[model samples]
Target: MNSVNNTDAAKPAAGLSINKRSRSWWSAPLREVLDLAFPPRCLLCEVIDYSSNSHSGSYCSECAEQLCPLPINRCLCCGAEIGLYSMSENGCTHCRHRNLRFESVTCLGMYEGPIRKAILAAKWSFSAVPIRSLGRLLATERREELQLLKVDRVIPIPQHWRQRVFRHFNPAWIIAEEIASALQVPCDAHLLYRQRQTRAQKRVPVSQRFGNQAEAFSLQDMHVVDGERILLVDDVLTTGATCSEATKLLRQNGARECHVAVLGRVLDSSA
Candidate 1:
């Protein structure tokens, strides 16, 4: 991974930043003791044979290497794999006429294989873990790409009040805080609000996802994003209707630009 040079920025809340305790003088010895008490295991593959990396770091090298890059020929607009370049126009046929709203989108890779496995674990199995372990893992994995977006602030796609109560967490919010720290940009989790609970995009057909999310978001205040370049963070990018809707609100409220970063992107062959 590339080194980050940004100065430390104020955190969104406690436990959102990488646990600094891991860097403490007592941290190593404490982790060593814990390792002795219970043999270390790979968090992803669950192997018991592992050495000290970080107190929270648990993936083995083989698992880490599974995070491959997106296809070289991709839509410059949305990061979807569009096969080899077909023309001077950068975006794929589906997106050529549609305004994506965001300036650009960065994704770890196609939503399959190891990255997909990790995202499933993050969103479904382990919401209670501090920092959302899968999010912290992916955020650390994708830090370099995120820094290059050069956005002024980070905002997580907001969860409606009812969703948060049911899920007890927002994976995007946790991922946003982890990324905002590395980018050294302020993170504002409250910048957007979900006015209505929309149907999960995964449950709806790709053709209908855009309309499902169209009226769900509202900018908290016009003055908050006045002339700001914002980075909208989310767990995954499929049809991208979610981010586009949120970006539309932010842009309408005076955000100068909006870029997106997601843990994974689904390349829709069915579309």
Candidate 2:
């Protein structure tokens, strides 16, 4: 459902690129039609009135102002804060010891507040609206940071068949499509496939999270990613183990460099 090239999942609704649509002549009328049918409500606060929606298409301006952006001095590699980053002046300590595969990471914000609630809704509420709202926000806000990744293509972290079935929606894939669309880059939802199903990271210990995802992803076509600068997108990043394992294998298969873009990131301690 997440493949941008497939036209089944990645293809957004009839009205999309919500930000871009705001400028079009038909946008106002279309929005009025939707508001009448769907009755616009702020994605964050669930307010009925849309006065603040003029400032934020999906959320109220108050919640929008409260969105916590990632600090400026994050670890250039993992998108972690300076305190959590295992890095030094010379290089990253984790990379030196654990050998993480991705070269860098970027994200919209730390996992908290409305972002957290929206993510939970996406995962458990059986609704695509929250995902679409968050995806558009990410696309509108993070374009410059995504561009600085110097990526050749975008890929979502793959979900195992069972997980995909259980969840019914892949937020990672949805979010990746947003980033890809904004960057005008190719998005391959099937770039990586789950070789086997494993327990969700939440069910495993923090120390074992990395191992749980080890050997989990197999590239759909090795040659497609060989020597490519790939951007792996995910919903939330906590331990960084899952992305690390995927990166390691992708690079072994000849991916030149793998970077990550995530919607939300929770520190290991807090998570």
Q: State every prediction's TM-score relative to the real structure.
A: 0.81, 0.81
Clashing pairs in 2: none
Per model, state how many residue pairs clash: 0, 0
Worst 10 residues of 1 by lDDT: 1-10
Q: Would you give me the overall lDDT of model 2? A: 0.75
Q: Which number leads on TM-score?
A: 1
Error of 2 at 85 (Å): 13
Our model 2 lands, by Cα RMSD against the true structure, at 5.2
lDDT of 1 by residue, 1-271 (tens): 1222222334434775355754577877877788888776665677675563534545666766676553366676887767684652556775665657887777767788887877777577543453355555556776776677678888989899988888867878877877776676877888688999998888898778889998899866779888989999898887889999999988888889999988788865532
Best by lDDT: 2
- 141-197 per-residue lDDT for model 2 (tens digits): 777877887788888998888877678688888888878877878888876899998
Shift in Å, residue 119, candidate 2: 2.0
TM-score, cand. 1: 0.81
Report how far residue 163 has shifted in candidate 2, in Å. 1.5
